[model samples]
Target: MSSLGGQPILILKEGSQRTRGRDAQSGNIAAAKAVASAVRTTLGPKGMDKMLVDTIGDVVITNDGVTILKEMDIEHPAAKMMVEIAKTQDDEVGDGTTSAVVIAGELLKRAEDLLDQDVHPTVIAHGYRIAADKAQDILNEIAIDIKPDDIEMLKKLAETAMTGKGAEAAKEKLTELVVKAVTMVADADGTVDTEYVKVEKRVGGSIEDSEIVEGMIIDKERVHPAMPRIVKDAKILLLNAAVEFKKTEVDAEISITSPDQLQMFLDEEERMIRGIVDKIVASGANVLFCQKGIDDIAQHYLAKAGILAVRRVKKSDMEKLARATGAAIVSSIDAIAPEELGKAGTVEEKKVSGEEMIFVTECENPKAVSIIIRGGTEHVVDELDRAIEDALRVVSVAVEDKKFVAGGGAPEIELSLRLREYAATVGGRAQLAIEAFANALEIIPRTLAENAGLDPIDMLVALRASHEKGGANAKYMGLDVFNAASGDMLKAGVVEPLRVKTQAVSSAAEAAIMILRIDDVIAASKSSAPAPGAEDMGDMGGMGGMPPM
Candidate 1:
């Protein structure tokens, strides 16, 4: 609003409210910090899990950072930006989401302290950008390079990812499977897509019962009970076309006045289905996987021909089957040929947990593999699935990058130590912001300590002392939550991919800089009269425009 000769111009609507300058900055910062704090405790090996129950009473029991943030019902803009940081970090590296959010929260907290000292927001933003770039450099300097064929290091990386999750109950077995699955599906060029590694979960078994299948596993069973349950030396066919009669493009009424005509129509339909079955038989394919449904007559003919078939298979599974069994998906029945059929050692129908699933295993050389994860309960299975996904993703990333770092807050402490030294070299108001960033990086170790029920201050001091001593192994020093002391993380086999740390640092710094620069917040009125706490809490509580309770 502006004034003209003492008369209000009322540029905005009468009830709309605006918060400017210091108030706006503080409001956005507080909201963003609250979001980060929500998931801060769910960090490290000893971290806790959050059981989030939605309005419909469905429960999500896990501590995966991205999952938790996604479950929250946040309404504030700044808070949403904080969630984006976790999401981006998770998407890029598949781990370190909790550290990213916590670091971002601590960065804003320190920025608040600097704001009180008369440091401009722009200076803080500029210094954070500089510190972020330098932090990446320091991270790369401390990273250790490994070969793609280094199975032990890859296993350590996978174990590090699944340590804090519920999969820890059988981490050794699951870790081995994760590493094997990832390595099996990796290309010769050292590129791993992680999609070819499939995870299929089922209840009514112990966690240790999970095993990796050498080929694809389709969830559907045989269309006809009379079909052979097992096919040895299986020749597989992948079909996208439906086995049922094709329906007309437009709706039409069939006038059946004579019984003879109706019999002829039925006979034609049977003949067509028989023709389709004949083509599949001539292709020398003992096993059939179809993306579309199969008619009853077609199933009977296929069973009579001693062929095992599964209908209505998912499109994704079909693609995987093509890769796993070395088959091409034929769209038309006429195109079926012996050369187009895929080869597999055996295809069988197995009953798991009282449900039938087709297992196409023992392929000659499968590019795609499946892991069947069995658990005792639904919640256990769900959590295990999440843990395996994280493990698989981290292993793939490590294999592709061929670089890793020590976990358990080791990289953060090393980065902080080096960044502070760099801060002193660039002495200015920006130096203070750079130093603030250095302190903010410590939040990872501090949170790790606090979540572990240890003395954070004492641990930080000891960690710093070790880094200052500056030996060949000094940079790898990290707090051991299990032992309640500082030790060399690399020697203890606590390793993670370098990409996780780099992605976390860059994302955290960028989010902090974005939230710090907001100097104004404008909210439109929701009612004719203002409600109590509406103006203040609406902007600061991350629940903008919600009526006061």
Candidate 2:
């Protein structure tokens, strides 16, 4: 041990000749592992909830790994890196934040043991990378191919993800809706893009019983008492600008000496407003999508003249509707009657369950996509939103790459078996890394079994033995193993281990090797006094841009 300035330095007697600070590497590794273990139990649907309380006693309970890790008030620099990994995983996959943290923790634990044996950080990194590569190969072999008609399977997959979220039934229903919505949006080219589907929820009624309106919904009251309540064969106009007259504030007094002056002002205002409405009707538009406020009198007049109106449209939705309808969005009433009002399309509503799902499909428009989500109690709706976001990510990945695997804890179990087989062939330090990786993969199924009050060790042993006997992989308690593709029974109480193990091994290996290359963490030194216009000094570090801890 020696001193480099004020920092204590540790000089290894072997391996690379580079000198390093004593606490830097080890401290970071320890911190990363600690953070990872914190979120480990919050893995699958049965995952335990983490209650995060801030200094003010504001409490937040969630099973969302990224949310939990992000809200956690961590002080250690190493732990922060682990949190970054979770964030990256959340951003990329929209799921797996928990898995990433768990894998990082496991890897760091193994690294700590290797360091104890003087294996060196560089060597541990090398071995981990090799093991990860082998694990990924196993993952690729186990991904079950998905088909367009596998709606029930998709529901099962989603249910596996949403079981403990108080929306098991909702998840199934929403999954079906999502599948149908995506399929409907698939163009003549046999491809489905997210742009073609739009899903929305409002507070007026149950989302389950909601209807898919051919046109957009506007939460507004009739502009005038005399305006028609409903307009048929409505030619809609989508206006991005204000429909009211502009005004400037000024101190003034009005003298009502005669009714003639009042009548003149009133006439002028009415003429201007009616002129705007007339122009819209003249441009082959019988309806209006107002992004801004509309005068009650103007709305009434439009309604009286048989023009339909929808007000307070969101800018984003307004643009989308405009694109879908091929209607021009005008900035002012003067521009309302442009020759490009596009064509008016039919709007209808369909009811499903007890929720309302609004579907807007434009005749010749290119942008098309559907949003299917669950709703119930307030918390249920919030959780459903989170689930929908995750579902969207998964769907996007599936549509884009044309492949995916069963999620939940299934993949982790599958990966372990694959890694174990690969570890048997690799010798030296690399073999140790592979064995560690395999053990890490087993954590999920082990947790699942333990959570179900079964002896995890016994279940694992039985699972392995059954697989060795040429039995199928999946085994639910007291259930027969049925073929995943066909209804035929493959074996009693036995399921294929390889399929589940493959996903776990692949995702783990990919994530682990991705995080192990970092060799430095840097922080900028602050000057005693600030320079003119200089910003505050900040810390900078790197863990090779790896996923969370």
Candidate 3:
């Protein structure tokens, strides 16, 4: 007779073997389908938000599919694979995590159906690739060639991307600025250099004098009482590090023992600083870009001496500015030259209560320019700063590449339809795989539907059928992907996937098919074993519910 523990273990092994009899392909398909179903209803701008609650009771709410997938504590091996697809999508587009996974799941589901009919996996993969290529073609056909004159459309696109993130008006304004900045840097080679535009925030007031500068702007006031306020034919000095002398051991401890001693210390400090500034001026330098700190007394002296100085220049900014202006950072001020003095065009200051805003423009062939964004509150300024940053990046990409697809869920939807067409031509197993790829593309619409609490399965089927019948079109709207009938989907109030039937169905189908193709699972063993006598032994009583060997 077998021991109790050993006998139970034997029985478990038998049961496992019996369960393992199922085909690996079918198992993978099923797992993918499950994951696809989870995020099907949260796709479009009208898409509802997902509330993820962790075991610790912490909650996060957002409509970003990528964020949702990342936060989920996924345990299933198949489900984890789907999450990776979402991650890849997010990295590429900065959005559309849900759509990629959803379409992938749908593709898998369709593949499973094809597999059941004896289609080969290799054929399905080939079909899927063909479909993807075709889908790209379709996208090109539908893409609206955005021109530089279409500033309004650009604004709308930027607004759509930043709608729920806060500060709508600011976002639009910043978008316009980004477009202008990009236009400024457009080269003969058709490339836009983003290195020229810099978004900076300082403690000063608003920029009243926002003129184009040929040279770099320095935020610091004059270095010394003797430094000149304005200098013509200014020789500019760019320093990568600080000019202040290090404190000696005796200098730190010295107190005002006598008026003579105090005056001597002050005079020494001033002399040291002024000597450096004088050296710079003697070298024919009128302006200075200091990466590190400058002495207060020295600034006063420099100002009195008719020299202009800018302190705390970042190393990267210094390099760019230097390259653009043909100015070099020298170790000693004696190397500066009047010929090297880039012209300073305009410099003005505005005051807002305790804050002062300085506008410096028209410097010597300056490449890097700074836009110091200021606001009353930290949150307000931060939000404005972010909007400006996004606008700059988008405009830069648009100007540089002159080719890009609508970001977010739009691309995924297009991918699904293309995959479907290819799936029809492939052999049995290959058809299944192609269908799976198509389904993965559907996750976007399904996610939209689920967010709206609609039935993802029904919507996905409808979407697939609609695309199969050719009822979709692309155009300029608030969001990248919007149904023609929905007006402005991104701006119009949040919509459920079920409410927008076409999007719902399409997204669900795509997600389901994509998820249905996963076939393998590898599980790691637990590090620790159960406690002694803690295992369940089942019923000890005989006859009715007794443990049996």
Q: Which candidate is the best by TM-score?
A: 1
Predicted candidate 2 versus true structure: per-residue lDDT over 1-549, tens digit per residue = 489898988664333343134355666666777887788777655567777888998776677778888889898766777777777765655566676677777777666676677665666666667776766665566555565455554444444444454455555566665555555555555465554455554333344643333334333444444544444454557787666655548876767678999998788888878877777777777666677888866886777776656667777777666656667777766665556574534532334334432233443543444353435554445556656555544454444444455443444555566667777887877777667766766666565555455576776665555444444544222211111111111222112222223333345444444444445545433336755445443322344675432
Q: Candidate 1: global Cα-lDDT?
A: 0.92
Error of 3 at 496 (Å): 23
lDDT of 1 by residue, 1-549 (tens): 999999988877778889999999998999989988899989999999999999999999999999999999899889999999989988888988988999999999999999999899999999999999999999999999989889998999999999989888898999999998998899999999888988998998899899999998888999999999999999999999999877789998899999999999999889989999999999898999999999999999999999999999999999999999999999998899999999999899999999999999999888999999999999999999989999999999999999999988888899898999999999999999999999999999899999999999999999999889998999999999999999999999999999999999999999999999989888887666667668664544435665545
Reference-based lDDT, residue 434, model 2? 69
TM-score of 3: 0.60
For each candidate in the order shown, give its overall lDDT on alpha carbons.
0.92, 0.57, 0.54
User: Model 3: how far is 293 from its true place, Å?
Assistant: 3.7
Q: By the TM-score metric, which is better: model 1 or model 2?
A: 1
lDDT string, candidate 3, 1-549, tens digits: 136855633333222322221276677667767766666655554555567888898776655556677888887666777777776544333334555566667667666666676676556656665555566565555454556545565565555445443445455455555566656556666565666776655433432222233334444454443644555544557776456655775746656888899899888887877777777777666667788888776777667666667677667767756654567766555555555544455544434345433344566545556655665555445545544554455555444444434443444455566656666876555555656656655556555555545566765555454434543333212222234221223344221111112222333334343433334433344446655654674444575665552
How would you order the candidates by TM-score, starting with the best? 1, 2, 3
